[model samples]
Target: MANHLDLEEQEQLDQFKHFWKQYGNAITWVLIAVLGSFAAWNGYQWWSKRQAEQASAMYEEVERLIGTGDLVASTRAFDDMKQRFPSVFYTQQSGLNLAKAAYLSGKPDVAKTALTWVAGSKADTGLAALAKVRHAGLLIESKEFDEAGKLLSTDFPSEFGGLVADKRGDLALSQGKSDDAAQRFNEALKLLPQQDQYRRLVEVKLAALGSTEAK
Candidate 1:
């Protein structure tokens, strides 16, 4: 009985060896691929988390600089944010906010610079359209009518139809085309929701045009 048991054990060992010889390389490669992919995924998760954390901290600093009313410093910080964290949401947000603050603070040049950056790259579709609109407004302020016309003519999301029409009206008005401006503002009124506060502003523009049709 002892000898029989030994023979059975040896036969099982031999079978295992044969299986290993047939499939060992294939199993080893499969395991390596799976482990390598898992490691890469984990590493990417860690790296993304670290990048977001750093970007959030920098955005806070940009906000602090803006609050201090030091636009020069704020612009510098925003530039740094854009350079280092271009893919981060905070970078685009900071650029938009900084541009608005700078424009309101009587620094249109700085606003234009920031707007140019945001509009040029187009990170988010909606935001990029907004940047172009505001940038076009600034160009109108500078009486660069042709350039503003070009910017405003680009494709915008469907939701931004009213805004684009309003800007087109403004551009037309700036060029002393009251008839065209009135037509554009009328188009804006149609595109805008009845309850939208912006419709009121467009109404004002129409009224100012003294177009009896608007009444």
Candidate 2:
């Protein structure tokens, strides 16, 4: 009986060895790939967290400068944020804020540069649409009618359609096309939500057109 048991144990060991010899290398490589991917994912998470934290701190500084009414300092801080954290949400936000501040400070050139950057950037689509609308308005103010028209002609997100229509009205009005301006303003009013305050402004513009036919 002892010899029989010994032979059975030997047979089991031989089968295990044969299985290992066939699949050992494949199993090892599979484990290595899975472990490598897990480690890479963990490293990426840590790196992204660190980047956001640093970007948030820099953005706070930019906001603080802006709050103090120091346009120059705010602009510099925004530049720094752009350089260091260009892909961050804060950088995109700073671009918008900086454009407004620059415009209010009588720096139309600076405002245009910032607005152009934001409009053309890979930021959120909605934010980019907002930038394009505001940039078009500035161009219209400068009497760059053709350029403003081109910008407004680009496809905007659905929520921005009303705003884009309003800008087109402004463009037409600038070109002294009162009939076309009234039509565009009516289109804008129709697209805008009834409760939107901007709809009231569009209504005011339509009223100013004096036709009373545009709804």
Candidate 3:
């Protein structure tokens, strides 16, 4: 009876060994791949967090420099922020700040340059459209009416369509294209909500052009 029990135990051990021999390599590889992927995902999450923290600190420095009216320092900080975190919200915000600072510092060309980059960047479509509108206005200030019109003609976010139309009207008026200006002003009026405060301003513009809203 002891020998019979021993033989049964040996048979069970042999079965386990056979199963291991058949599946051990595949199981080992699967576990290795899964663990490797998990490690990579965790490492990426940590790296992204660290990058965001550093970028936030630098962006704070940019704000401080801007508050102090140090254009050079602000510009430098903005450059650093853009270089390090171009996809971050702060990077796009810094572009706006840089444009405003350049304009206030009597550098219209620099302001236009910054705005143009923001306008054309693929970071955020909404921000890009707004930047294009502002950049167009700056071009108008430079007496580049045709260029301004071209910029305005470029597509924008739907929400900005009214504002862009109004700016185009202004550019047309400045160019002495009265008929074109009236057409654009009409389009802008249609886009503005009836109860909007700015709608009254558009009405005034239409009145000035000897045109009245229909219906």
Model 3 lDDT on a 0 to 1 scale: 0.83
By TM-score: ranked, best first: 2, 1, 3
Ranking by lDDT: 1, 2, 3
lDDT comparing candidate 1 with the true structure = 0.89
- Residue range 1-215, candidate 2, lDDT tens digits: 99999999999999989998999899999999999999999999998788889988988888888889898898888888878877777777888988998899899888888888788777578778999999999999999998998999898999998999999999999999999999999999889988899988888888898855345
lDDT of 1 by residue, 41-124 (tens): 999999888888998999999999999999989999998998898876677778889999999999999999988888766557
**TM-scores of the models, in the given order?**
0.82, 0.87, 0.76
Colliding pairs, model 3: none
After superposition, the stretches of candidate 3 with alpha carbons farther than 4 Å from their true spots are 1-41, 193-200
lDDT score, candidate 1, position 128: 78
For candidate 2, give the lDDT of residue 38: 100
lDDT string, candidate 3, 44-101, tens digits? 9998788778877887888889889888788888877877887766667678878988
| CA lDDT scores, all candidates in order | 0.89, 0.88, 0.83
